[model samples]
Target chain A: MRITCPHCGERDHREFYYKGHALALERPSPDAGEAAWDDYVHQRENPAGVTRDLWYHEGGCGAWVVVSRNTLTHEVLGTQAASEARA
Target chain B: MGNLVAKSPCKGLLPLSVGAMSASEVETGAMTMLSPRKGQDGALDEAMRAVHGLGYPAPSGVESAGEARAIWFGHSSVLLVGAEPGQRLEEHGVLVDQSDAWAVVRLDGPGAEDVLARLVPVDVRLCAFPVGSTARSKIGHMSGSVTRVGEASFWLMVFRSMAETLVHDLKSAMEAVAARG
Candidate 1:
C-alpha cells in the first residue's frame, strides 16, 4: 500500500507505522474516572467500513498522520497531518 | 588533552566506481538544520534570504545559491549546506549543527537513477523527480535523503555511522545496473 504523505508525497507503507485509531488522540482528563480511562486505554471498535486511524511516518517526514481508509476495500480515502486533523 | 584528529565518516570507504556510475563522499562544509519556530516561518524566510541569499525551500524542494544549498529536511525543517549560517537566523528558528551527523555521498554518471531505483522506493526518474527535487526516504532499509542535484547526479545522505553500509549498498546497485547493460 502507498500512503500519500501531506508533506512528502506518496510513499510505501513500509515507511509508516500503524498506530491504531485516531481516537487515541482524544485522551481523557486525569480525573475522568475509571471507566473513561479504561475505555481510553483498552477499548477499540473494529468497524468494517470507513475508519480514521493514526499512522506515524517513521521513515520519511516523522509526522503523525490520520489516514481515512475503508476497512473492507482497503482503499485509502484521504490523509491529513495529525496536527491539522480535528478530533 | 591528547591531540584529536578529525576523521571523515566515509574515510577510505568511498570514491567507488562500477562501470559508468561513481559514488564519492562529499565534504559538506557545514550543515545546519533550520526549523522555524511557531509563527516564525516568514521571518525565518526573510532572514535566510537576507543572510544567505536563499529562501526557505518548499516541501521536497531544494534552493541553491553558489556553493550554498538548502534542502528540505522532513516536515517544517530545512538543511542548510555548504554555508555557515548567520547569527540572525537563530532569532527566527532553531539552528542545529548537523555537519558531523550525516554522511553525504554524491552519485554521478550514467544510470545514476537506475542505481537508486534498486534501493529507494521513490520514483527518481528525471521526469518524475527533476533536478532540485529532494526526498527523505529509505535507502536499502536505511532512512536517508535523496536530492537530484543535476541531470545525472544525485546527493544521498544518511547517518554518519551508516557510511559504510550506504557505500556498500550503492556499489552493489551500481554493479547490478551496469551488469544489465
Candidate 2:
C-alpha cells in the first residue's frame, strides 16, 4: 500500500487522493452534438481486473500520478507520475 | 450566545438574558474563522469562491492573510483552514463558530496507506495520487476530507465527537497491517 513518490520520497496512502483511471479520453467537439458529449462524459468501461488509475497528492507537491492496481484485492501494483509516465 | 435570543424556552443552552437559566450551548465548531489581518492569496481565494462558495471575515491580530480554502470536513462544518477561508464566504450571513469543533488527524509514514486501506476503498499509491488533491470520502464511517499534505502525510479533518472513533479505527488498522508484516 505504500508507494514511493519520486518528489516527496516514500509516503503513506493517506496523503494521496484517488483519481480514477490513467486513460485520457478526448472531449468531443461542440459540433458533435449533445449525445456525443453525453456519451463521452457519462459512458466508460469499468473493468473489474487489473487497471491503471489517476490520483492526486493533495498534501504534497500537488502532482498528478497514475497507479496500477488490482481491482478485486485493492493491491497497488505500481505508480508513476502522469508527467513522468508519459516520458 | 446572542443568537439564542430568537428561540424561547431553550433547554440546552442558557437564554439570552441576565436572569435566564444557564444552559449548555450546542457545540458547533468546524467553521472556525481563522482570519489573519492579511487574507487569502489571490489564486486560493478564487478557488475557494469558485469551489466551496465561502468568504470568512478577517480574524483580528493575524498580520498575515494566509491562503484559505473551503474544505468540508463533515455534514455541518465547512472549514476555512488558513488566514481567509474563501473569497465568497459571507462573514455576516453565516454563523462562524470560532470554537474547536474539529480534530485534525495527520497520517504519515510508509504504513499510512496500509493503515487507510483497511477502511477506504480508494488506492493511496503515490504514482496515482497527486498533491493538493482533496476527496469527500468516509474514513471509518465519518465523512470528511482527506487532503494530502506531504508525500507521506495526509491531514484528515473530522468531527470532534468522532475523534476517538477515527483514531481507534486507524490504530486498529495499523496494528493489523503490522501483524501481517
lDDT of model 1 at residue B68? 99
Query: What is the C-alpha lDDT profile of model 2 across B1-181, one tens digit per residue?
Result: 3665432111222211111111122232234542222233443444444545553222110111234454432222335654333344443224366446565666666666666677664566666554554554557776555766557666665566766666666666766766676
The local distance difference test score of model 2 is 0.54
| Candidate with maximal TM-score | 1
After superposition, the stretches of candidate 1 with alpha carbons farther than 4 Å from their true spots are: none
TM-score of the second chain of model 2 compared to its true counterpart: 0.55
The candidate that wins on lDDT is: 1
Off by over 4 Å in 2: A1-87, B1-78, B84-95
Provide C-alpha RMSD values for all models, in order. Answer: 1.2, 12.9
lDDT of 1 at A68: 96
**What digit string (tens of lDDT, one per residue) describes model 1 on residues A12-55?**
99999999999867889899999999999889999999999999
Instruction: Show the colliding residue pairs in model 1.
Output: none
